[model samples]
Target: MGALLFRLQQEPAWFVPLAVLGALHVAAVAFRILSHLVLLLRRPTDLCHRYGTWAVVTGPTSGMGRSVALDLARRGLNLVLVGRDPAKLQDISDTISCTYAVQTKTVVVDLALIATPQGDEALRLLRHAVAGLDVGVLVNNAGLAKPCAVYLHEADVEAWVRMISVNLWALTEVTAVVLPGMVERGRGAIVNIGSGTTLTIPSFPLFSIYAASKRYVTQLSRSLHVEYRGKGIDVQCQVPLFVETNMTLGATASRKRRSFLSRLIMPTSDEYARAAVCWIGHGPLCMPNLGHRLEWCICHVVPDWMLDELCLRLNLWHRVRFQRLRTMRASRTNVVNDGCLPCKQV
Candidate 1:
C-alpha cells in the first residue's frame, strides 16, 4: 500500500492532463443529461396568459398542427386554424369550439402556391385574417415532403417547388407577418416544427431537399430565439421523429393502418404535440418525446461514418419498399379500371 501510494505520487506528467480531460468530458455529459431532464420535467408555462388570448396555427386541419391547435384551445386560448382546405379547416374550427368552448376562426389558403399570383393573394388573405386579433402564439407547422424518397434527378420539379414553397417560403412569410405584432406586444411564443432527419440523421441521401429545408428551420429558430429572447419572445424549433399522421402514412391510409403504425414506430400526433408544447419555453431546440430524446443521444454517440452508412441503407430500403407498394397499388387500380370499363364491341 505504501509503494502504491508512492507510485501514484510519481505518476507520468501526461496523467494529469488526461485525467483533467476525462473529468471535463464526464462533467459535460452529466450537465447535458441533467439539463435535458430539467427541461422535460419542468412544468409548462401558462401559455394562454403569458403569450396572449389567441394562437395562430398553420396547417391546422391535420397531423401535428391539428393536435397543437386543439391543445392550445383546450388551454383556454382562442385559435385561428389555417389550412388549404376550407371545409377541413371549418370542421376542425367547429370541433375545437365545441369541445374546448374557445373561439375559433379558419383561414384557407394554399401555402404551396408561393411566388404565384395566387400565393400573393393567400398571404394577403392571411394578413387580413389575423389583422386585429391578439395573436399570441404562432406555430409554423406547415411543411411538405416528397411522395416517396427518390434521387434528386428523378424527383418531380413541381413537387420540389411546392416543397420549398410550403416548407421555407411560407414559414418565413408567415413568421414575418406575425412576429411584428408579437414584438410590439412584447410577448409571444413561436414553435417551428422541424424534422429529425436534419438533426439526428447524418446523411439523408434521397431526402436531401426535405432535410435541407428542415435545417433551415432549425437555424432560423435558434437565431431568432437569440435575437428575440430579450424582447420577451420565445422561439423554439421542435424536432420530431415519426408521428402517426397522414404525413407519415399515406393520406389514403385507413384508420386501423394508422393505429398500427402508431403502435409500432410512431407516436400519435396528439401525444407528440402535447409533449412539444410543454417544451416551448424550455430551450431554443428540443426533442420533445422520450423515445426521440433517447434516439438523439444514441445518434450523437455513434460515429458520423456509422450514422451515414445507417442512413443510406435505411433510406434505400424505404425507397425499395415505396416502389413495391406503388407498383402493387397501380396493378390493383388497373384491375379495378378494367373491370369498370364498358365492354367494347368485339
Candidate 2:
C-alpha cells in the first residue's frame, strides 16, 4: 500500500485521471441505485386517469396476470380479462366486480393455438371485445414454458412449438390487436411480462427455447418503445426472476425445500404483482421486485462464463429432480393398477 501511494505521488499527473475516472464510475452507479429507490418509494400513477377507463390483461385467471388484473381493478379501471378457461375467467371477473366498483369482461381464448382456425376465430372475438372501448392499458402477461427442463435435442418438438406460439406469436398478435386503438387515441401503456433468465445470464441451456423467446420479448418491447414514444405509447418489459406460480411450482418446489436462497429469491405471485403494477409506464425495462433488482445488480458483476455454468448446473439439478418425481408417480400408478382386481372378478 505504501509503495503504491509513493508511486502515485511520483506520478500524480497520470494517477489523477485514473482516480477521476474511478470516482465518476462510482458516482454513476450510486445515481442509478438512488433513482431506483426513488421509483420504489413513490406513489403509483392513477391508471384510470393517466391511461383510460378500461385495461385489458391476458392470462388473467391465475398467477401474476390475475394479481395485476385485480390490482388494476382496485385502482378503478374496468377490466377485460383474457384467458383459456371461461369458468376461471368468470371467477376472477366476478371477484373483481363484487369487490370493486369496476366493470369486468371475460374473453376466453387459448393463446397457444393462435395460429389455427379456432385461434383465428378467437382472435376475431378478442378484436370484437375491445372494439369501441377506451382501452388504455394492455398487459401481455400470457406465456408458456416447458413442463420440465431438457436438452434441446431431448425436448419435444410440439411442446417447444406451443411455447413459441404463446410466448411470441400470441403476445405479438395481442399487442397488434390492442395497439391500434391506443394509437388512435394517442395515449396508452403496454406491459409485457419477461423472464429474468434472459437478462441475468449469457445462456440458459436446458430451457433454451423459453429464454430465447423472452429475449425476443425484451427486444420487441424496447424497439416498440422507441417507435411509438412520439405517439404517446409506453411499451415496457417487466423482467421477473422466479415467482411462486403454478408454472414454477413443481420446478421450484424441491429447490426451495433444499435451498434458503431459492425461498428468498422467489416471491409470491401477489407480492410480485403489487410491485409490478406500480412500475407501469415508468421505463422500457424494469425488475419490479426489490430482491430481484438486487440479484440483478449482483449478476452484472459475475463473469459470463461463470454465470453460464451456474445456470446450467442449476437447471440440470431441477431437470433431474423433475424426472425423478415423474418416475415415482408413474411407478405408483403401475402399483395401483397391478393391485386392482380383474374387471370380471369385481
Candidate 3:
C-alpha cells in the first residue's frame, strides 16, 4: 500500500485536467440524449390517426397557436379552433380540412369577456366545441403583447385590462372549464403558451403588464401539475424568447419599443412551436431557447443585487435602442421627443 501511494503521488498532475475534460464530455452527451428521449416520449407522433381525441386550440387564428393546430392536424386529431376572428378562423378550418382530411370545428367567441353562468357566450362556445367528444388536449395560446413606456407598464388602462383578459383571465378560465372533465376521465394534456420574460428578473422592459400576466400562467401551470399529477392530467407552460411572429414584429417596432441583449438572440417561430408542442404531452414548463435558459439560470444562481444592477443596465440599453428606432423613422412619422408614431394598425 505504501509503494502504491508513493507511485500515485508521483503520477503526472496533467491527468486531473484530462479527467475533467472527459467528465464534461460525458455530461454533455448524457444531457443531449436525455433531452431527445424526453422529447420523443412526449411527441404527438404517438397519437397519429388517434381519432376522437378532441384538441381545443385557443388563439388558433395566429402565431404559435396556428402552428400548433397544424402540428396536431397532421397527426389526425380532431380539432376545435377558438379565436376572436371568425373570418381568419374559417380560413384555417377550410385549409386544415382540405389538407389534413381530419374533422375540424370552429368557435368564434372572444375570451375577453367570457362569463361564468350558463348560456354565457364563452363557456357556451367551449361547451359546444367538445359537446360529444372527450377532450384529450387543450392549448391555451391566445395573448397580446402591447407597447409601453416608463420603467413599468403604465400603459393606457384599457390596454392593460385587455392584455390581462386575454393573457391571464382567458387562459385560466379555459383550463378551469376543461379540468373537471379531464380529472374524471383520468387522462388529458393542457398546454399554456407563457412568456420567457416572466422567468427573468429584470421584468418586461416598458411592457411589464404583459409579463406580469404571463407570470400568473407559469405559477398556475406549476401548481396544477402538482395538484393533478396522479389524475392523468398534464399541465405545462411554454416560454419562448424573441420568437419571430407578427406579435413580436409589432411589439418590437412600436413607438414605445426598445432593444437590448435580446437583439443578439433571435429564435424562429417554427422551431419554437415544434419544441413547445413536443413538450406538452411529456410534462410542464418547457423553455426552448438557449439564451433564455442561460438568463433563467443566472437569475437563480446569482445574488439579487448583482442581477438587479444588470437588469437596470439592460432596461436603459433597450430604451436607447428604441430611441434609435425613433430617430431612424421617417421624418413625417416622428412624434414628441423624437419618438416614432404609434403603428397604423396591429
Candidate 4:
C-alpha cells in the first residue's frame, strides 16, 4: 500500500484522484470475486464450482445435452465434455470447437458405468481425464425414460438399474469429485435438468422409473439450493416437459403411450436448452414455456376428480383403439373359419 501511495504521490493531483477511483473499482471487483472463491473452497461434495475455471457437461452426444453444450460453448467458457462413446464425443467436440471457436476437450465415460459397485474402474478413467482441471460448472442432465409400451407389468430390471445409475448416481459421483475444489474456491454452479412429470401428471403411463428419477433430481436441487445458498454456490433445477427430441419422436413403442396433449405443446430441445442455461446461471429454477404455466393454472382451477376422469377417459380411449382392432381381428378370424369371403360379420 505504501509503495502504491509513493508512486501516486509523484503523479499529478488530477491523475492521482482518477487513478485512486479506478483502483478502488478494480479492488471491489477483486474482493467480490475473492469472497465467492472463499465460499467455494469450504467443502468438497456434489456439483460445485466456487473456485474453478472449467464447466463439466455430461451426455453431450445428443438432444438436450448436445444443445446445452453448444449454447455453453458460445458463452466463452472452456468446457469438459463427457459422454459414453469416444467417437461421438470427439465428433461433438470437433463440431462445437470448429463452429463456435471455443476451447474444447472430450472425456468419454459412460455415466452408467460410473455409478456401479465396480464404478471406480470407470471413475478412475474419468478422474484421470479431469485430474488436471478444476471444474466449476456441473450440468446434471443425462437420464433415460423407461421402455414400456402396453403394460407396466413388464419392467426391464437391468435397464432400470442402468437408468437409475445414469439418472441419479452418475450425477452425484461426478459432483462429488468436482465439489471439493469448488467449495475450496466458494464459487460454482450445479444445474440439474429435471422433468415436468412431477407436476404435469402426464399419462406418460409407462415412465414410472423415469419420473421417479427426475423427482429425485428436482428434490436434490432444491435441497442443495437451500443448504448451499449462503456458500456462494448456486444449485438450479430445470424441469422441461415433452421436449422435441429423438426420445419423444413417438416412433418408439415405449413412448407410444403419450397422450395427444403431451405430444401437442412439446417445445424443441434447443428452446429448452437455451432457457436452461440462462436461468440456471441466474436463479434456482427456470420453466421454459409460458403455455405450460398457463396449462398448469387451468389444471389447478379444475377439480381433481375432473382431471382424474379426463386421464381415465384418455386411457380408455387409448385402449379402445386396440380393442376395436382386436374386434376387427376376431371378426376376420370367424369369417375365415366359416369359409365366407363375400362379407365378414362380427
Candidate 5:
C-alpha cells in the first residue's frame, strides 16, 4: 500500500492531462444535469401578463404550431394565428376562442414566397393584423423540410428555394417585424422551433440543407438571447425530435395511420408543444421531450462516422419508400385518367 501510494504521488505526465480532462467532463455533465433539474422544477412564467395579452404564432393551422397556439390561448393569452390557409386559420381561431375563451385573430400568409411582391404583401397583411395589439410572444414555428431525403445534387431547384425561403428568410423577416415591439416593451419571449438534426448528427447526410437551416435557427436564437437577456426578452430555440406532425408523417397520411413505433418515439404535437412552452424561460436552447433528450445524449456519445452511416441508411430507406409510394399513386392516377378520357369525349 505504501509502495502504491508513493507511485501515485509521482504520477506520469500523460495521467495528469487525462485526469484533468476527465474532471472537466464530469463537471460539465453534473452542471448540465443540475441545470436541467432546475428547469424542470421552475414554474412557467405567466406569459400573457409577463409580456402582454397578445401572442403571435406563425404556422398555426396545424401540427406543432397549432398545438402551441392552443396552449398559449389556454394560458390566457389572446392569439394572432398565422398560416397559409385562411379557412384553416379561422377554424383554429374559432376553436381557441370557444375552448379557451381567449380572443383570436387569423393572419393568412404564405411565408414561402420570400422577397417577392407577394411576400411583401403577406408581411404587410401580418403587420396590419397585429398593428393595434401589444404582441408579446412570437413563435417562429413555421419551417419546411425537403419533400424527402435526397443528395444535394438531386434536390429540385424550386424545392430548395421554397425550403430556404420558409425555414430561414421567413423566420428572419417575422422576427424583425416583432422584435422591435418586444424591445420597446422591455419584456417578451420568442420560441424558435428548431429541429433535432441540428443537435444530433454531426452532419446530416441526406437532410443537409434542412439541418443547416435549423443550425442557423439554434445559433441565431442563442445570440439573440445573449443580446437581449438584460432587456427581459427570452429567445429560445426549442429543438424537437420526431413529433407526430404532417412534416414527419407524409402529408397524404392521416395521423391515425402513424405506427405504434412512431408513436412511441415521437411525441404528439400537443405533447411537444406543452413541454416546449413549459421550458420557455429556461433556455437559449433545449430538447423538451424526455425521449428526445435521451436521443441527444446518445448522439453525443456515438462515434460520428457510425452516426453518419446510420443516418445515410435510414434516409436511403425513406427515399425508397417515398419513391415506391409515388409510383403507386402515379399508376392509379393513370388508370383513372384512361377511364375518364372516353367519358370526357362523350
Candidate 6:
C-alpha cells in the first residue's frame, strides 16, 4: 500500500487518473452485484395489486407457462389460460381453480395458425374471451422450437414456418389483441418469455431459427417498454437459461448423465417461474433466475469468440443427443406396436 502511494505521488498525472478510473470501474461492478443481490432477496411484488386483477397466459399447459400461471394464481390474480389443447388447458385450469381460490378461464386456440384464416377466427375468439375483463397482465409465453438443431437450409421448411408463426406472429397478434384494452385502462404489464441463448452469446449456430425468434421478442419488449411506460404499462422480456423444461429434459431422458453441477445450474420450470414472477412489472429485459443471472455474468465476461464457439459445440452435442433420444423413442414405439410391452410417451 505504501509503495502504491509512493508511485501515485511520483506520477500523479497518469498514475492518479488511471487509479481513479480503475476505482470507478470496480465501484460500478460492485454496485451492480449488490443491486442484483438485493433483487434476489427482496420480497415478491404483489402483482394482483400492482397490476389489475385478471392475468392472461399463453401456452399455459406446460413448462414455464404453466408454472408462471400457477404462481400468478397463487398471488391472487384470476387467470385466462390460452393454449392449443382443450383438455390440457382444462386440466391446468381446474388445477389452478381447485388449488388457489382464483377464477380460471381457458381459451383453446392453436397460436401456430395465426397467419391463416383460422387464425383470424382464433384472434376473434381471443379478443372476445378477454374483452371487458380487467385483464392487467399478459404473459406471451407460447413458443415453438425445432425438434433438434440443424442448419437452416437442412431444416424442414415447414418446421421453420411453424416456429416463426408461433414465436413471432402469434405473440404479436396476442399482444395486439390485449394491448388496446391496457391502453384504454391506462395500466397493465406484459411479460414475454425469451430464451437466454439469444442474449448471452453473439451467435447461436445450429438453432438459428429459435434464436432469431427470441431476439425479435427481446427487441419487441424493449421497444414496447419505451413506448408504453408513460401510459402505466410495464413490458418485460424475461430471458431464462437452461431450465429443466420438457425441451431440455427430453434431450437427456435416456441418459443418466445430469450431474450435480448440471442440476445446480439448470433449474426446473417451476423453480424458474417462482423467481420469474417476482420480476414481473419491473425490468425491461432481465434474467429472473439467480443461476441464470450468474451464467449470464460469466458469459459476458468470456470473450465473444470463445462464447460463440462454446455455444456451437454445446448445441452440436445437444443435436446429437436429441437425435439419439428420438431414435430410442421410435424403437420403443415399434416395440409397443408389436405388443411387446406397454407404451409410455416420452
Off by over 4 Å in 3: 1-45, 48-52, 115-119, 147-153, 249-265, 289-346
Which residue pairs show collisions in model 3? none
TM-score of each: 0.87, 0.88, 0.74, 0.69, 0.88, 0.90
Compared with the true structure, what per-residue lDDT tens digits does model 2 show for residues 1-346? Answer: 9998888789858778988887986787677678778987888798878889999999999989999998998899999999999899999999999999999888999999898999999899999999999999999999988745798888888989999999999999999999999999999999999989888888988888999999999999999999998999999999999898766644455443546565457877887888899999988999888778778878877899999889889999989887987797777777668986332311
Candidate 3, residues 35-114, lDDT tens digits: the string is 75666565355443221277889988877788889888876777999887889999989989999978889988678775
Candidate 1 lDDT over residue span 1-346, tens digit each: 9997688779998987888887986677677768767876777778878998889899988889989988888788998887899889988988887798789878788989867899889888888988888888999999988745799999989889899989999998889889988999999999999988788877788889999999999999999999999999999999998877864634435555555444434677898888877887778998888667666766877899998888888889889988987797777777677897443321
Order the candidate numbers by TM-score, best to worst: 6, 2, 5, 1, 3, 4
Instruction: Go through the candidates in order and give the C-alpha RMSD of each one to the true structure.
Output: 4.6, 4.4, 6.7, 16.9, 4.1, 3.0
Candidate 6 differs from the real structure by a C-alpha RMSD in angstroms, to one decimal, of 3.0
Give the per-residue Cα lDDT of candidate 6 at 319. Answer: 81
Q: After superposition, how far is residue 138 of candidate 4 from its true place, in Å?
A: 1.1
- Backbone clash count, each prediction separately: 0, 0, 0, 20, 0, 0
Q: Candidate 1 or 5, higher TM-score? A: 5
Clashes of 5: 0
lDDT of 4: 0.71
Worst 10 residues of 5 by lDDT: 337-346
lDDT of 5 by residue, 121-164 (tens): 98988888888688889999998887557889988989988999
Alpha-carbon lDDT, every model: 0.84, 0.88, 0.72, 0.71, 0.84, 0.88
Worst 10 residues of 2 by lDDT: 337-346
Q: Give the TM-score (vs. native) of candidate 6.
A: 0.90
